[model samples]
Target: MRIQEFLQHHGIATNPFADEDAQTDLVFKTACIRSVYHPAWDKIYGDPSEPATAVVFGEKGSGKTAIRLQIARHLADHNADHPQQQVFVVPYDDLNPFLDRFRERFSARRRRRPDRVLSQWHLWDHIDAILALAVTQLVDRLLGVRDARHPAARDEPLDCTMLDGSQKRDVLLLAVCYDQSTADNRLKRWQQLRRKLGVSVWMSYWDIAVGVAVTAIVLAAIALLGGWNWLLTVWPYVAIAAGWLPCGWRLLKWTWKAWQIARCTRTLRQTIPFLRRMLMRFPAGQLEGQPLPVRAATDDRYAMLDKLQGVLRTLGFAGIVVLVDRVDEPYLVNGSTDLMRALIWPMLDNKLLKHPGLGVKLLLPSDLERLLDREDRDF
Candidate 1:
């Protein structure tokens, strides 16, 4: 007797337990995801209007991922019903890319030691990774860059015109700093996004213009006053070099800032030169007073989150829900309880989990729950 026949005989359409992973479970994805309820459903999927943090630790195959999928499905439905007050979902489950980049930051010996590599993981790294994921997805949707891998891409493209000038600047600034998509040309996509947002980046090239103008003036002056022979003089060369001072200075500043950001954001796979180029694409005025993840502390990340929330609010996302799961699945962790503890312990901070307009659901392995007893009251 085949499984389908057996299930049909029992009044069931399909085998609910056929697939062990919630992500691939057809029964759960199609039917049970909407109707089924875990006993702790309300706690994990809290009030979307006023999002709150919830931490759940379940053993392997205990439906943690199922709950995550359920929350996503429910949020999709909620957003469809209440278009104005939607919750932006950031899926932080895929950690391999991040872990790979993080490992590259360490020495070979340290990289071999998964425990030591994970020990270097901090809350700020998590924040950076989450921001990168969210910003990248938002950019994809806003620019209509469809990728089948991204669930949000299946929906209609976002209306970029909804954002006013300030809001557009916020989104572009966020994308400039945090959009980490390997598939697309970063600068090209950014330009597309800028055009979509109707934000002018003409001012961003002022340094180059200044350099060109100064050089042209010096050459024209030399040609008229001193003739072609003057071009061979050191004075003309000096004048030409001086012409590039503004552009060189600007490049140096952006390089230093990019180095700082790359150093601080360990989980992101960004080359300093690449980051500098991206920063150079933004107007100085737009980037001024903006919060970038250039510090090891969480303050800047929180500020950036606030900026992201503001942009999302204008796009009708009233709040943000961050789903963190599959900690033990990362190659660095590889199901090591100690490594998982090291990786996830930093994110348990109250300040981050309970931030205003943000709800972080940390679906962790039950093995790490034992370490909670060792934690102090503040944790």
Candidate 2:
């Protein structure tokens, strides 16, 4: 029997078993994402009232990437339905940049096991990268909504009044390191930026107060020395420096630290162009260019993660789902079970996997299943 005749006799509309990539095949992709819903869909997507995280393990051709796309589509639908309680979706499927960064940063390692070194690359890096991705996407979406010049956003209808001007600026600045916007938009947000964002502060009141106190003390000393005439001539310069010196120094320190982060991490480094564009927005160059609130490598990850969750909450995002897939594609991993093991180990951190406001859907390759037994926690 001919193939078409056999297919017609079988009552099949088309070749369902074709040897094409499911992600690219139109019929297969639609079937996976829209037509058919998996049994575990609800569990993985989770309750909207409470954000949750889940891990899905499957081998090649097991529909892992398909599931990721399904979740993203579902969340987008949910957002479209309920704009007031929208969930931001951050798709972090790319791994090449991360792999490149790992290679560059740790060139001369002890060279024990590739997997071991991958594990030692630290969960903090993974967490930091995920947070950065979320912030970048959020900024891009907001800018696209406000400005029509950029690429059209996939955002559902969102209530702009969810965030105040200052809060909006805070979120905008967080993204400025990742995505570019017009100079006018950048300047607007820069001007609206607050001195403090929760525990984080752009410029501290104590620093300014100290400068004022020092200026007063110096002026008093000059008065006691009976050199009021000379003091008058120099007082203006002294006062100006003292008033602005502390603020400028703090900004310089933050800029230097931000530069370090950009240098050390490829994820952060990509944001440099956006940072420069933001800097140019300020004609006086007085705006602080410190975008991410990263401190040291270790502590900053957790701190920034918490801050990012808070920012998302303030932006009226009831949930933020980070979809991670494509584990074996990068040259660093290259389908090696060892490299995949090392890379995915840190991501299994319970704290990150089960964040309150953030939902993580980790679509892991089946090869990672063997390593799961080593650190078998409830997470």
Candidate 3:
């Protein structure tokens, strides 16, 4: 069927999972759906001043990610027009429970058919974490958020039957994505992300312990047979130990640093970007001309977002789309100003934003919208 006609049947709301872009606000994005911009959906949102930044704000079940996926798919099918446009940072790690979320959200949506999904639960709380980075992708190297090796990657949404077995549905992670505004409550819960982290930590520690234990066993056997001389002379056991110990130490250090990064990230993610004005000191430049220097901050949010945006942009090649799911959980729990300052405000009027051809869409919390409106009186 014709793309526009299909969109009409589905309604205008953006559907990251749908095949094409619908002209409406909740309209899906695809190459076939002509934008008022270019004949094709190629160039960066046409004029940045026009779209500025198109955010898909909502909680997890409000369908924000679904909308983003549809956009990505559209970009993939017609990337020829936007050879430079790409899906910079697909949250491949975040699709762990989409079907269940869809089911929950669909149920809630059936109840009221509200014009927007932000009223539901803290649907897009997770967006609070990733939106800034997504915004940075517009002019960065990772415009499309993929490696050069696979610039035109696209995954069609699972068949309806994928979620058909029971009253509620469940599905495995199929592809990377940017947001999760599909939940009924809109960017509300992020137990899935937290659960994923818990599983990752558990598995990583298990693997590390296993590796060390195996190495120790081998070393003990060497000692049993002879000593350091016998082991090192033949197996280089002493040298091996020397090399492995530092490697192991560094690995452990990095892992610990990563944990710290996660914790620090949750705490100061919002305020990081605003402090980026301090980038004057760092020796930073990208192979891609679209460059932003590293900045000094009492916090690492600025550095992290800058780096993530830069690297991912270069990888994306085409362009970048930021999908922020579950954006309200943090604000709902710990509403702080530094985060708002360091991260959110920086991107709101960021230099990266000044660059042409980028799209930063987020599914944020309704409470955040209210809070931000109150704080800045944007409302």
State the lDDT of candidate 1 residue by residue for 132-235, as single tens digits.
Answer: 99999889889777662553223777777888888888888788778998768887888888888887777889988888988899878877786888867799
Off by over 4 Å in 2: 2-5, 8-14, 106-120, 145-161, 176-252, 263-266, 270-298, 376-379
Better of 1 and 3 by lDDT: 1
Give the per-residue Cα lDDT of candidate 3 at 44.
Answer: 29
Clash count list over all predictions: 0, 0, 102
TM values, all candidates: 0.92, 0.70, 0.34
On a 0 to 1 TM-score scale, where does candidate 2 land against the true structure? 0.70
Write the residue-wise lDDT of candidate 3 on 187-264 in tens digits. Answer: 122224223222122333443455576677777877787766665374655544654664466455444433433233
lDDT of 1 at 113: 88
Error of 3 at 81 (Å): 3.6
Model 2 C-alpha lDDT per residue in residues 177-259, reported as the tens digit of each score: 44323344644543333222221333335566677787777777778887677655966567768777866776675566556
The lDDT per prediction is 0.85, 0.62, 0.36
The model with the greatest TM-score is 1
What value does the lDDT take at residue 253 in candidate 3?
A: 45
RMSD of each: 2.4, 7.1, 16.1
Residue 57, model 2: Cα distance from true site in angstroms:
1.2
